[model samples]
Target: MPAVTADTLTLPRIAPPAPAAQQRPVRSVTTAPSGYEGEGFPVRRAFAGVSTADLDPFIHMDQMGEVEYAPGEPKGTPWHPHRGFETVTYIIDGIFEHQDSHGGGGEITDGDTQWMTAGSGILHIEKPPEHLVVSGGLFHGIQLWVNLPSANKFNPPRYQDIRGRQASLLSSDDGGALLRVIAGEVGEHKGPGSTFTPITLVHATISPGAQLRVPWRPDFNALAYVLAGNATVGTEARPVRKGQLALFGPGDALTLAAGTSQPAAEPNLEVLLLGGRPIREPVVQYGPFVMNTREEIMQALKDFQSGSFGVIPGERIPHT
Candidate 1:
């Protein structure tokens, strides 16, 4: 105590605050996948049993073809019109080509993503590339429909394409977990995709025993869909498996851990986390068109028939 020098002082280590108490607890509602036939291929829909009212903003979500496409067997959604909503397509494998009536066309290969905003109206086709259709390998992807608010329902149509590495990536402290921000922010990292409504979409991959904490806006409705493997989510540590959707309760943050409470032969966990501010407006959906009222839906169909929804390049107009 004679002289308070730097060498004579001992610094005490202060541990970081516990995060669990401040984080939101996860309450999971498990939903099963329903088999459905799309235009040319089969699909397993995870949002069929759940109502759009419950999901809000996110009206539909479909997991496309984990099925093998033999040569000359690969098929895709033909020309279709959409309005008052946005479609987000994330590729997990193979290749998919998309062409819109506005002359916006491109190919999204493995790990690519396409976000199409069909504000007023737009016609588009999404299918496998010609090479895949001929030499057909495995094809798989996920398409999610996000509903627009009443104000932006009639905005101009637009598109955003994000390559695999274009998205923001965040790794865990131990480097066992990775999160790819698709339309939201994780810490200081922001996603590449632009969103009209306040929403967050993230794709995360976690190794066995790794835990990832995701910060979410308290006012946003949040849910997580497990694409592959298994995960224990939230403070309650609810178990969610592959091909299943897990809906969460109110919380500022979500805690997701790979595998179950009991250790086994657990594989890597791949999940998509989506959250958006609830749009309480009325929602009327007809086929591919989604609007706030039935009258709007009818007008969307009329526009499509009148050739106002844009035209696909080189597409022939069928004679009546």
Candidate 2:
């Protein structure tokens, strides 16, 4: 669970909510269902039951393993294709190697992020390095799919590798929580990752019994997903735990309080705070392609089948 950390006492403190600030209220809380992804790796389908309308600009998310893999047990995705969206992969406690047909490749470890925009179309693969495969350890991370609007659906493909240390660090007003802004703005601070759509992504660790309240954009839709431990969300204090996601109603600010106690193995409440300006456009998703219409999806298939997504490199790194 070591995505990013800082000594709260030394970090910039978030200003307390103003007296007139309207605290967001919880609209719904749903538990993510356990599932398996690429090569049998465990995952929690974080947006399984959420509506596409409520998750506008954000299509899907998977909370990848918090599991400790025995040597030779780690798994990763095979070569895949994507279009009309961006994939944001944040590694919290392990290493992941990514390679795309367009000559974008890199190794990202603890706290690092790989933001890939599969605009128009692209083929890529994500896997563990040979050494990690031979001597597997802990692996935990998040993979979020951010949808591009109709106008930008055919933009050029691109990639951004955001290192862990580049994240903007801040502290709760009371200095009881650490907030790592990985993308977008939080108050006057901004993260390193550049996004096509406006969005804010923050990973916060709240000490037991601590409270965190921060101003939120009224135009953006707010959501909080528990990565570890337990906590309560919204001004009404709705209970939420690991694998649960809380969606909030429109408001000026949001509030969260960690439970007084937690599992022995997880002593703090770890939450991923995310929100984005709604795209409010039609979304059509096929196996690996996301488009605005059935016709576009058919064209994407034809393009992929015709080798238009770029060819794999002649020399390849075999998966361990």
Candidate 3:
């Protein structure tokens, strides 16, 4: 959706916004640099969208990792297993179940989005939903991991259930700007963001001095994360407040305005953009496990002490 002339503010370098429907198209776009930063319990700022250092073939990006149980704490997230990768969750509030062994089970809340494809293997878990378990005020959400281009890496397991009315809402019917298409497509208003990778997820809102110009795919690889009341991404005008995170340079597009501490009753501003098409493999890590070289990460810790990456389902929160 590109074509605006008012208030002056623009962007353009995008190119991949026109291929949606269970998604599976491709080209290029690289920018999965998020070095990891987790904050659970009373903590909620997972990776802030990591800037790549450890988990390279794309191995983790948690935007919200809050799991505060407190009263009888015993919170959860165990029963794990993954291989070559791809895991994404986008809930905006509480609720859970999300079981897995590849059998697949689900339940996401508030704006729902779950796309698991632990290719080559599986065994997952996500707790806190025994009917709200004990609830919290803002369990919010965001989770990502993608990498499986060793020629599909071993393609096997799969799962995708992105609900929110099948995604796709780039406002401006006359209501200012409000795009919320969780994956690819941002033009003809046809998006349901499904991706094995080659991704694109958008959630933009512009008003109060409005300026939203979107259109690009020049080569993929873009970035923008402002999540609250401040804006300005790429094309260098600088000033991307509200948790700062911007990395754009492919032809540059996405220029938002209205700031100065920005106030006017807040005007609803939240932004999050993602990329796809970057399998530049060869990575290895020790925390939360990520593999591909370094002797396959010492054979994944010798296959997790020979038990073979099993048993981490409820108690053993070790592995720091």
Considering every candidate listed, which one attains the maximal lDDT? Answer: 2
Taking all chains together, each candidate's TM-score versus the true structure is 0.87, 0.97, 0.32
Model 1 ranges with Cα > 4 A deviation: 1-22, 260-266, 315-320
Over 1-320, each residue of candidate 2 has an lDDT whose tens digit, in order, gives 78578899999988977889999999999999999999999999999899999998899999999989999999999998999999999999989999998877788888999999999899999998888899999999999999998888889899898999999999999999999999998777888889989999999999999999999888999999999999999888999999999999999899999999999999999999999999988999997899999999999999999999999876664321
What is the clash count for each candidate, in the order shown? 0, 0, 18
Model 1 Cα lDDT, one tens digit per residue, 1-320: 00011211132211222475356666555665656555668776868667777689899888886778889998888888889999999888778888888766688877789999999899888888777888988887889999999899999999887887777666655566666778876555678899888788888777777787766777888788887787888778888887888887776777788874433433578788888998999999998988988899888888989989877779532211
> Which of the two candidates, 2 or 3, achieves a greater lDDT against the reference?
2
Higher-lDDT candidate among 1 and 2?
2
Per-candidate Cα lDDT values, in order, are 0.77, 0.92, 0.56
Q: How would you order the candidates by lDDT, starting with the best?
A: 2, 1, 3
With candidate 2 superimposed using the best TM-score fit, by how many Å does residue 297's alpha carbon deviate from the native? 0.4
RMSD of 2: 1.8
TM-score of structure candidate 1? 0.87
lDDT score of residue 10 within candidate 1: 32
Per-residue CA lDDT of candidate 3, range 1-320, in tens? 11111321232222332333122112212233333232123323433445553223355555553334444432446566676677888766665557675456667776778888766556677665543555443465667676766666457777887776566655543345666677776554545756666667776666655555665554456566565677654434566555455655444244555454455545556667665555666656555445566776566556556664334344321110
